[model samples]
Target: MTTTPSLSRTDWTLILSLALLTFVLGTSEFVIVGILPDIADGLSISIATAGTLVSAFAITFAIGTPLTMSFTSHLPKRKLMLTLTAAFIVFNLFSSLAPTYGILLVLRMMTAVVTGVLISLAMLVASESVPTGKRGIAVSFIFGGFTMANVFGVPLGTFIGQRTGWETTFLLTTTLGVIAFFAVYRVVPSQLTSVKTSIADQLRLLTNPRILIAFFIPAFGFGATYVVYTYLVPILKGVLGVPVAWISPILFAYGFISIFSNMAAGKIASHNPIGRLRFVFLIQALVLAALYVTTSNVTLGLINIALMSFMAILLTTSTQIYLIDLAEKFNPDAKGLASSLMPVASNVGIGMGSALGGLVYANAPVMTLALVAGAVALVTALLTAVSHQLDQR
Candidate 1:
């Protein structure tokens, strides 16, 4: 019989530190959505142009993560995380000081590359530190930091940005990064490491058809949400007729609900990842579709927004577990690559969804984001079914 690893105070501290780092990183990534209008005005750019910052960050993160993980696979986890955190701090500070829209865009892409690496590595660290039975909880704890960012960080950042300026929001992220750097440096053990694999092996694992399909599931599922989320501020202001002051509160509620959803997904995912994902995708698709009908009423629109937020991230932990397990099954040596790809797939979805949302916003009524997103969620559900069948076989 297997025994659970006995964790000491240090282990718990390490886990919590990683979670805190993710909170900081997630806030850096997501806070921009709340302050995009401010960014546009500050830089004298169109809101559409400002929206490209999201796409730029997502695309860079998607492309950079696997490559970075492959190259750094042999490095000591503690050193690698510290280096990434240091870079994150420097770049976020620069982002706050960016003099032009173009400069800010470039800075965001650089920050995103580091953000991607940090998230994947944190998961790897958590999984390695904990017993198999507790890995799901560990992952959930890390993700809890992310959900908390949405719950408290994003809304608070938005409020600060609205009052003081968007630069202040980035500065706050920089402060958080500084805290993360210290926590990681002090708490994360330097000896933590993963199985080393050759570049060729990592590349081969990434090319597997099953793994590729798994990757695309998140791309579409998350893309479905980003379709509407990229323009959430505008939607609240225009469609729901919500006052600017009320937007942050509503987002806070949406984000708070997401925390519970994320935790629940983590717990359920360990038991039946494919089944949980299938159910989540179906509900998400339905919620998004309901948005088309409900968004005209302020109360209903807020409720729909909350529902969508709750449903949108339910697959995250499951997808992460599924990809890691699949990679280990196919090539244990390439597990790092597999683990790294989860966020890559997610960012790809974000980029696609946000870019598509931009197009829809330009050409159609803003409410149409829900329809487009709903269709994409349906596609995600189909992908989940296919993945489950493949797993069963």
Candidate 2:
């Protein structure tokens, strides 16, 4: 028999603080999309060149996460979290002050490296802070912070960037980072021990087929969404005929719906991780297919976008929980590396999707992105089914 640990108020406070930390980092990462045009105009670069900032961040994050985690594996969780938070704040501040696009790009890469490690560490903290049974909920709460970033942070940052400048968005992120740093300092318990594992042990987990497959589940799953999502503004404005002014609000609505979807995912994931992922991925694939069909009409297009956003994030918590659980069961000594790989795989998916979207945008109509992404989502569902069967066996 298994028992769920009871969480106290202090645990909830710590969880909320970690969530806020993710919200701050997520907003800094994602706000670039909303302000891409401003960044291009401000730096006298083409929008396409400015867009590389996004890719730079994602690529760096993908490469940097495990590397950073390996180096910091010996440090206490709270101390490492605080250190990363400080680095994040300082780098984002430098980003806002970057005079040239080149300098800004470098600063963003620095921030991404730290942010990736920070998020991975945050997950470890959250999972350790909660009862074993509630790990899913804690992970979801942290991810919910990112959802909140999309909901309030990105739109508001977009509005501010449009009016003042894109640099202002970075400055704002820095401020939020400061607040998050203090919150973590005050609330998060400092006695949490680190997961100590040698480099060889960590590397050995990579050789495991199950870990490798589990890592790619998110890579393809997120790739499916980001392929269309990278060009969502153009899709809404040029293809769907939505006015420029309404794009933010539409995104705001999409983000708003995502919050509930994220919470619902948390609940469903706790009960049935594999089944929940299958359902979410299947719905995501179908919705992307519907998005391809609906792009010609504004109402249907908006509805499909909302549905896609809703279903897209449903896999996040489950993915985190499943991977971590897998790590604990199969690769206990290297659970840190396993946890870190979740975000790394996610960024890989983001990078792939964005790169593919760019290719489609150059050669084909934007609506075609949906078809390609939908196919990817279907592949993700199949992978989930295979993973489920393997677990059952």
Candidate 3:
């Protein structure tokens, strides 16, 4: 076994740069939800059809990321990180200039190809670059970028899109990406270690049942949130009767609460993460179920949404650290691949939940999304229990 060195100031810079990049990526990925109505209106598509953009991007991210990680596993981390961030910027630029819905959707799919992998790389870099004892907090800080994206990026993008045009939101994301690219280039070490594992070896991690189940825990656990989250805009307006002007501020509040969620997740991961996560999922289910009862009252509904937002990310850090540790035990050479699993699974859940929510929206009332998502959360709890039992054995 190797010992991790204490973190230097340079190491902190490296971790924070990676965190900034993830923030930009997370912003671009999630800002669409905040601006969905604007995009729908701009393209003359039904909001339901527009919602498919989130599902499409997530599904592509879910399916494309691990393959990308496998292929790129041998490359130097710094160069790969820089190259991916550049591609992300270009894609977002083109997405802003896209002529029609088809073109925009295609741009989003192209962007998705790199988004998940970029996030995985960020985690891989932060985990490797920091001391072993601090890996949980370090990785959580990387995820904190996503929560901050919720706090600042998404709300700001939504406000911009609402005021100017939906295309402008992509431009905002592009600018952030540029800043992240330079930060990464300046701070991330040019010579960080890269995995030499073959694609076949990396893919072998999937063959292990423990690895597979571990991956799905994030998928189902986080998927429950996307089910309702994908439609939160409409729910806020149509169900809760929130004014159009209040949307961004409400989203700001949700993201603000989520920052604490990410912090708590890091701490939880430092202990018995798998055992603790089962109860976390149980609480998530109850909160999601509460959305059904609370939707009729605006104050109660917003509070419930805040609770849902908080629970949405509680599993992330725990599952992330868990996956990397499990991979080290089972497939030591495939840390990059292991790093991809949680993000991939979370996006899978996002795609599955968003697609499911779209179907429900088409046939049922939008408010029904709460109940459907609650059921998914319940299953997530069961899966967590099973995983915890397996951990014991």
lDDT of each: 0.87, 0.87, 0.88
Predicted candidate 2 versus true structure: per-residue lDDT over 111-158, tens digit per residue: 999999988888888887788778788888899999999888888888
Q: Count of backbone clashes for each model?
A: 0, 0, 0
Cα lDDT tens digits for candidate 1, 281-371: 8889999989888988988988889889888788887788788889879988777788888788877888789889999999998888899
Clashing pairs in 2: none
Pairs clashing in candidate 1? none
lDDT (Cα, 0-100) at 357 in candidate 1:
96
Q: Return the TM-score for each candidate structure.
A: 0.88, 0.93, 0.88
Off by over 4 Å in 1: 1-10, 34-52, 99-103, 159-167, 233-245, 296-298, 359-368
